[model samples]
Every structure is written in structure tokens, then in C-alpha cells.
Target: MSFDTPDDRKYLESHEWATTDEPIRIGISDFAQDELGDVVFVELPDEGDTISHDEPFGVVESIKAVSDLYAPVSGEIVAVNDALHDQPELVNEDPYGDGWLLEIDPSDESEFEELMDADEYEAQIA
Candidate 1:
């Protein structure tokens, strides 16, 4: 099945996606939510927490399995999707929009550029 691999963001092989916009938004890919089935819980870092590129930042638990959420870039987490605490289904319903995991103030913007583009991400998933 085709997934929404938006060009405005970069992707990790682990299936996380990070936007290039300011206060860079981060989330799992549409493909990942689909693969995981219904999301039941999300364990996220509190705002102000520091995360490093390729490091585990949180957990996404689904009906099918629990998965670790990794950082696509190193930075301070400025915001987290508190909505997920009460409405985990949002991840399955809108993985790219309201389902976004967190926002970061990147310490190294260059890390984002180093991640795979949409085409490369799509190809990896394909």
C-alpha cells in the first residue's frame, strides 16, 4: 500500500520523520502506524528534555507491539503532543498532522539534511 511520504520532511530508516520547519516537528511515518496497528499508548519525553540523533526518545505502544521512538536530530524537546496521552488513536488516524509526537529546537540543523529524502524513504519502505 502507498504511504504518505511528504517531501517537506526527512526520514530515518527506523521509520521516524522530522520536518524541516522551525521548531522541527517529529513523528512516526504513516507506514509505521499502519504496520503497528492501533496505537494504544505513547510515552513521551517532557518538554525541555535533550535528545540526541539516533537515540531513543520515547515509546509508542500499539495493539500489535511496542516500539521505541528515536530522534532524527539532536536537540532540546520544546514541545510534546500531550493529546496523545488521552487519545493515542490519533497516531493511527493522522500520523503526520495531529498525531505528531514532538517539536525540537535543533542543536545541529545539518543533521536533518543528512537524513533520507522522501524518495529515498519511500524506496526503503518499498
Candidate 2:
């Protein structure tokens, strides 16, 4: 399946998406979920757990395979979408919105600058 990288969201070559906000919400990209096939399980970090940029934070299990979910910015996890435990397919159906995996109150704002813009990320997957 092909995925369109949204111009509004910054991306990682690892196939995660990020945006700057009070608490950054992170999730697998549409491209990622499409490639992984139907999602079956999602393991996200607990609230208050600290994570570093580009580091593994959790796992996304799809019918095809299991992939590590990475932190786009170093920070403390503030929340996770608990709904995913019952409906993992949300990651495949709506990776950007309701399917979001976690939220982090960042350790440092500068870390978000390291993420790739949509244009650069499009070139990466192309």
C-alpha cells in the first residue's frame, strides 16, 4: 500500500510522525501502517516514562510483522491512547488522528527541529 506523507507533519525515516505542541503526539505514519499490513497490537510507553529522540519507545504489531515505535523527541510520556488495546486497527485506519499512540511533554524543544519536513520525508520514501 502507498502512503501520502502529510505536509503538515514532520516525519522520521523510521516511519513515525511528529508535530510540535504543548505535548507532542506521536504515531506510525500512514505509509508505515500500510506497509505493515493490518495492525493487531500496539504497545506504548506508560505515562511519565521518559524517552529520548530516535530511541525505541514501544512496539506496533501488524499481521505482517512487529515494528518498534520510536520517540521523535526526547521527553516524558504524558499519555497513551488506551483505546488501541481493543482496536489496534485504528493505527491502520487513521494514523494521524484517533490512532495516535502517545503524547510526550518534551525534555527540550530543539529536538523537534531534527525531524524531517514532509517534503524531505517524501523524498526519503520515494
The digit string of per-residue lDDT tens for model 2 on 19-79 reads: 7667788888888888899999998878989999998999999889989988888898889
Q: Alpha-carbon error at 5 in model 2, in Å?
A: 1.9
RMSD of 2: 1.2
Q: lDDT of all predictions, in order shown?
A: 0.95, 0.87
Candidate 1 has which clashing residue pairs, if any? none
- Model 2: which ten-residue window has the lowest total lDDT? 1-10
lDDT of 2 at 111: 79
Residue 56's lDDT within candidate 1 is 98
lDDT of candidate 1 over 19-56, digit per residue (tens): 99889999999999999999999999999999999999
- Give each model's clash number: 0, 0
Off by over 4 Å in 2: none
